[model samples]
Target: MNSNVKVIEEKILSNNWYVLKKITFDYRNQSGEWQTQAREAYDRGNGAVILLYNADNQTVVLTEQFRMPTYINGNETGMLIEACAGLLDKDNPEACIRRETEEETGYRIGEVQKVFEAYMSPGSVTEILYFFVAEYSKSMKINEGGGAEHEQENIEVLEIPFKRALEMIETGEIKDGKTIMLLQYAQIKGLL
Candidate 1:
């Protein structure tokens, strides 16, 4: 254990879908001197993204939703095109992802294959996102997708041809960082 790296205190700042905490820690810098730093860390709960693929139609399921953060920042429409994703509340990554997939797209994924795990915006946030892809078939039916009502999510699920999804990326329509990374990884691995 690194003795210099110690968390002195932690304070909760927010407790919405994503929780924010202020942390104070001491660490040894390259100069070999102990330094104290304070950071506002976002505990976004373990997040997960799913790439739902329809094997028969060669398509992928995606969602479009209004993101206030993006809207406030500069997106003209304030809408984002992304894979089905959500924050894990006490559940493991796989289970959380599977549940999110069903709630967001009405797709019950079978045999999820883990693709990647990464930190989203590590500069100040402590969100670890797990990415997975599951083979979907036309036989899969949509019961009723729109996210959980308790969370006030108004999601519109869309199915796009695999090739068109790549086009959306090239056209700069898919702007979410994690979604881009996962799609690129899938394409590179010839899984798209």
Candidate 2:
């Protein structure tokens, strides 16, 4: 609690699986004025995303799944191609991404490089996502991963050429933010 800021109140808007809250606060502006503001924050918890690639094969592993939020918001099919990712329930970011890689893409990843962390939607979401990159080989595939059956995740695995995956970004196929950032990072770092 800085002296310049004070929390006025927090009201819960929803508490089903996660929480959504309306927060009211007052801030002492630099102009020597106090200002009150209200903002809604959705707390779905933090998550980790990893881009699995094969330098030898010049390819990357990706997954496609239906997203309800995207669908409701005018993504006609609601299907998005993205890197392997999942919520960080109790595990650390690296452990979470490794587990998600195997669960969603069927590749047991090792030697992952943590690239960066980002607030995906800073204005209204409290999710700080950890981004990573890892190398994968065919031998790492232990099972045909479609995510946890109990969670009803119908994910499709894709092994796309690195160059083609980049092209998808221009053609509007790979629209997921985390995936795009990781892909662009790969391009910038010459990982592929």
Candidate 3:
């Protein structure tokens, strides 16, 4: 919509799992001269993440799983400890988080507070992530949550002290962006 830029053309680079497109565009420079630029963007849809905490227990629920991308990018083990998250296939953000929490962490939570939303990576990825926080207790654990079986998800649930979760960040053990953000949010806001 800006007069400073115009998309020249877009080509589908790949559509195997999600859509990746090569975008060529005409951009007006600082001097008002048009220049051609191209960039590749990956569209994997949007997702939601949540950090579940229990004030009484001073604990937070987290999940661990193998991440192929992390493995290839200098992560020795490729295993990442992250907050429960999932792509919002067709549900609203709240519904998506609720569903993902139960599926990934085995907690049927009620009343989640939307903390914020952010783009985890914006340079070449088209995904805006929604974040949430909720109070949880042992009474809510309904099953051994390890993600959905049909989706081939093999998530490991972990419940640890809130203070320990923060230390994991310093130890470089919890490197996931969304998870870290949520944990920091809890700490700054004294949610625990």
Candidate 4:
């Protein structure tokens, strides 16, 4: 059996926050026959998601934003309800989550607990999502979460009661896979 696969060619598709690539690889099958396959793959920088909870107010913060991809795919409402998240550029996952949490919700979390690490879309993308949970005091305020100007993100931060957030999940208001998974995980682990 051959265990090595060689890349024949690689091409860049997009060069934004995430880069898409087309790659052709040559490999040998179990039958000892050689073959070449081409595929479009995504090269996403490391990412972080923070489940911000306001302990005093018994509320959780979520963001709603217009996602063009989701709108074009199937969702009638392009707005996605999700935790504060972003891609890591120069910082580690933990630092990235903390920074994003502050940028997206104005909450400066002191200690963040890592929940899990996962692949957002494993089939074709190389994006690894680091999930975290942080407790914030009720005094934490939402100044304005409109993302970085360079990225052109228009973010709306929503501070809803924990129960209401769960209700939104149950009613399909939150359709993002990562958000759903994190919320469900928190519920199962009694973190929410």
Candidate 3 C-alpha lDDT tens digits along 1-192: 899999999999899999999999999999989999999999999999999999999999999999999999999999999999999998999999999999998999989999999999999999999999999999999999999999999999999899999999999999999999999999999999
lDDT of 3: 0.96
- TM-score result, candidate 1: 0.92
The lDDT values for all models are 0.86, 0.95, 0.96, 0.83
- The list of candidate 3 runs beyond 4 A from truth reads none
Ten contiguous residues with the weakest lDDT in model 2: 101-110
* Candidate 4, 45-124: lDDT as tens digits: 77999888765677788888899899999988798999999989879999999878877777777889998899888879
User: How big is the positional error of residue 96 in model 4, measured in Å on the Cα after superposition?
Assistant: 0.9
Candidates sorted by TM-score, best first: 3, 2, 1, 4
lDDT of 2 at 163: 99
What local lDDT does model 2 show for residue 111? 96
Residue 77 error for model 2, in Å? 0.8
Q: Estimate TM-scores for all models.
A: 0.92, 0.98, 0.98, 0.87
lDDT of 1 by residue, 1-192 (tens): 887699999999899866899999998988889999999988766788888886567788889999999999999999999999988888898999888988988887779998889988898888888999888876665666889889899999999988888889889999988778877777888775
**lDDT of each residue in 104-186, candidate 2, tens digit only:** 99999779999999999999999999999999999999999999888899999999999999999999999999999999999
By summed lDDT, the worst window of 10 consecutive residues in model 1 runs over 137-146
